[model samples]
Target: MSFSSVPFFITFAENPELAICAEDSIKGARLVLKPFKNNLLALFNVDFVQGLFGLATSGNQLVIGAEDITLGAPLALQLLQPESGKLQRWDIFSAPGNIVSAADSCLAFGYRLRTKPPLQLTELNAPPFPQWIFLPFTTTQRGILESAV
Candidate 1:
């Protein structure tokens, strides 16, 4: 099957060996992914078992987000070395979530809400908002109110 047929997952690697491993892993399961380019392998159609949804390189570690079929729809992050392939997994949440964005030190995740949405921020590890100042005026501050009964 052609890689273009897959949904959406991409991995950029400069190391040829690492890229090969990624391609093998994706294709071994009879999955379609974008053709590897310049030693980079891009995975698409990531809805299959243990399908990869996101990937980011942070310093020497690679952060990966994948669907864990054993746990249902919970998407988890795995930190690993591309060269060594040693990894540790961290569960983010269960209800069909994916890594929406990533930076040098952080990643953003989005989840599907099932019930009435409460007022809450969904971006995980989001940066703090700037503090704002509030000014309140007393009733006596008004000249007409001070002069009236």
Candidate 2:
């Protein structure tokens, strides 16, 4: 399965910002994401699961079930735009209700964020990305992903 650069949702009203990233909860990390302005959550590719919250530059699109975990957090997030890339980032932090995923797409767990990201995230180690593959919405996609178990 693949996903497009455009997120499932978009944030146009607030021109969002990156509030925090509580990357210290997930296990077997397979996905990364950021929050935006219009209740949009941006998912990204993660190379590996380093620790509770370790960062990587090489990875694949985050897949649910494959990651094998659930989101465990109430995140305070904002949107971020890198200087040279099409992929957007959501700078998020854990809140009181945050749940970490041992292995699952952040979106599959459940949360709300915006799309209009702030510019502070460019200073981080975010690499350049021209495009991404968003999984198609179909029964086949669901069956294939579900069968991974």
Report, for all candidates in order, the number of backbone clashes. Answer: 3, 40
Q: Write the per-residue lDDT of candidate 1 for residues 1-149, one digit (tens) a residue.
A: 11112223232122212111132232112112222333223322332322233331222123333332221123233344343221113232332232332221132332223422111123444433111111111211234113234
- How accurate locally, in lDDT, is each candidate? 0.26, 0.24
lDDT of 1: 0.26
lDDT of 2 by residue, 1-149 (tens): 22332222211222223212223223323233433222112323322222121121112222222111222333222122122111222212322122223222132123233422211112121232111222212312233223233
The local lDDT score (0 to 100) that residue 112 gets in candidate 1 is 28
Error of 1 at 137 (Å): 48
Scored by lDDT, the top model is 1
Give the runs in model 2 whose Cα sits over 4 Å from its true position: 5-15, 19-27, 30-57, 61-149
TM value for model 2: 0.20
